[model samples]
Target: MDKLKINIAGLELKNPVMTASGTFGYGKEFSDFMDLSKIGGIFVKGTTLHERQGNPYPRMAETPSGMLNAVGLQNKGVDYFVSNIYPEIKDLDTNVIVNVSGSTIEDYAECAERLVGLDKIPAIELNISCPNVKEGGMAFGTCANSAANVVKAVRKVYPKTLIVKLSPNVTDITQIAKAVEGEGADCLSLINTLLGMAIDINKRKPILSTVTGGLSGACVKPVALRMVWQTYNAVNIPIIGMGGISCWEDAIEFILAGSSAIQIGTYNFIDPAISVKVAEGIKEYLDKHNISHVKDLIGQLSV
Candidate 1:
């Protein structure tokens, strides 16, 4: 993993491959398939100030090359994590990052502040761009001012690596990236599922109970790559690229575009070992291309 070492903002990753929040659950679930320590990082499921019931049934639907989810940030709350989950995962070898979400500015800040006491948990990924919830999910992400406000509030409490994940639903993603950057975000993660809807033709109604859900998987790669590239040029901070990355080549395309790291999301459903395979595949790519380090590939794309 020598050549695979990457420093996204201040977090040192063994490699640039990690499981996206929600898709991977806690690091414990995948232990049967792969070593948790081998993962670059684990972005745990979304945690709120209190336990959430999440969205209603029919929250998931399959599409042509992707999947839509209206999971609605379902979790057992931040307190539950600090009390129960933290003790279990604290010993894992990889970086444990909390994906923090809330309904108000205070909710996000308070949740982050609580994790502050956990030494094992080094950072928090602010889920300001979650598209599934109605109250505070995508609301804080669509506008620059709202996005900036969320970051600013959380920045006050979260002392460690502060990564603000962005949404692709905006008219201009780079603007949102720049706004968060101005608010002192250490790193940025792009293109959290795009907002889309599916229909149940048989019933002539929306497939998702919520009418619309966040679209992810292979279908979103192109849009995600474009946004990562645009945001990379727009801001000076590090970027973690996600969306439609099911293979090593897809991961390389993102590094070439400007991603310092990449997250494996929906693809985990297809192959639980996909993250490990992709990690090894990246090393093989470096050896073949004679590239000394993975960081060399970041923003290496030439016009």
Candidate 2:
């Protein structure tokens, strides 16, 4: 099979398929279904400075082709992850990137500082696009200036690969992409679930308790591809593209659109091993087309 390896920041990945944050809990949960080390990397869940219980009971809602989640960044916090969880998973064969979700700028900075001295963590994914919280959640990513400030604050303390996760809920994603690139962001992950909702007409109530939630799955493929392609043109940093990627064709589209790598989100719920399958499928396509390195196809699309 053809090699499908790529680099994010300076770290090498076996293949370019990874699970998005929040969808895959720490690597432990997925190990039940398939080997934890099969995919390129496991992004794990979104962790903060404190443990979050998540939203109310109705934290998730199902749309026609996607799912909405208001699971408010529920995890055991940074200290616990470093102290308890890190020791257990440090020996895993794949790259372990800790995804950080914060409600304020200080929260993002503190999380980055705590992770910098920890040798086990190879990188940190700044989750600037969570729509559930009221304060500094998606607010930071929606505006270019705020997004740049968050990246700047984290850059001061963290010296490793810093991946800024972008939100799709904006007018011009290129504007925000340029803003973060100017402030020392090492890489970017795009189209983190579009804003959407579902309703129970008979019950006269909203599907999710939060009234609105972030939509992810097969339905969002086109929109996400467009955003990734646009951001790829706006910045030079490597982009980890995601949103509605479920098959090999979808994976090819993301690469042709100029993504250095791709992340699988809602597909994990349907098939726990989707990322692994995608990794193999990409290799097959590359071999059939006589393509060597996967990076050879990035941004090779015709307008």
Candidate 3:
């Protein structure tokens, strides 16, 4: 039995370490730094039904112990990914999961449907964090009904594993989690960047182009862990916890909270090879504690 191996829904991961969407690019970008197959999976950058220019420049701002990004889900669209990016990553040794985003339910469904034919792609992280333009620009993940509707739509077209990435900007994260699970979401990856902002005192203006952006890094771990633990108790589905996970210890903390898997986001920029290091560290922690398998550690927090 591979000690570190675990299964999320039907998707098997060599370990719980995965690269967060938009942070690890398409896995190819990090090829020069680490062995792609060393980690469990890689969630590629966000993909949409149509090309997105993303937020204007000055979209990123650094804060104390964290950073805020309003880089809008800029991408060349799903068709371009199918035609251009898929072939390049289809043969990597690890799982190549796409992060699907859209402004509407139809866009989400259509974009997800495009990846159904690809043999190498095993799953997609449905990013409901994107604002639903048709619904007055409110994020779909912020509302239980809206979250369910999007997951329900994508579930009908996406036959493979569907992992919904929950937004931290919601009033109650678990409510959205249960709603999506009820609508057929296979797994959940939570605490997507918290809503935050930064101001340039000198310029007397907001640092980011969008005035506010998603806050990530070590600063958001406490909130992410709390939400993961809460959602774990509320839903039966496995949770893929993320947000401010920078090291193996942090990864282990998430596992104990309820994350069957964890993704490394902002920290990836600091260390290109951190994902593999995290996987190795997890294995070491398991050995030190005499834990036979990593799955045994899931949600085992004493509290």
Best by TM-score: 3
Off by over 4 Å in 2: 130-138
Quantify all predictions' global Cα lDDT against the true fold. Answer: 0.91, 0.87, 0.93
* Model 1 error, position 112 (Å): 0.8
**Candidate 1 structure quality by residue, lDDT tens digits, 12-104:** 999999989999998889999988877799999999999999999989999989999998889899999999999999999999899998888
Alpha-carbon RMSD to native, per candidate: 1.6, 1.7, 0.9
Model 3 lDDT tens row, 70-166: 9999999999999999999999999999999999999999999999999999999999998899999999999999999999999999999999999
Query: How does each model score on TM-score?
Result: 0.97, 0.96, 0.99
Provide the lDDT at 117 for model 2: 82
Model 2: residue 190 alpha-carbon error in angstroms: 1.0
After superposition, which runs of candidate 3 have C-alpha atoms over 4 Å from their true positions? none
Candidate scoring better on TM-score of 1 and 3: 3
lDDT, candidate 2, 1-96, per-residue tens = 327767789877888889898888788788888876777888878889888888886989888899888887878899999899988888878888
lDDT of 1 at 17: 97
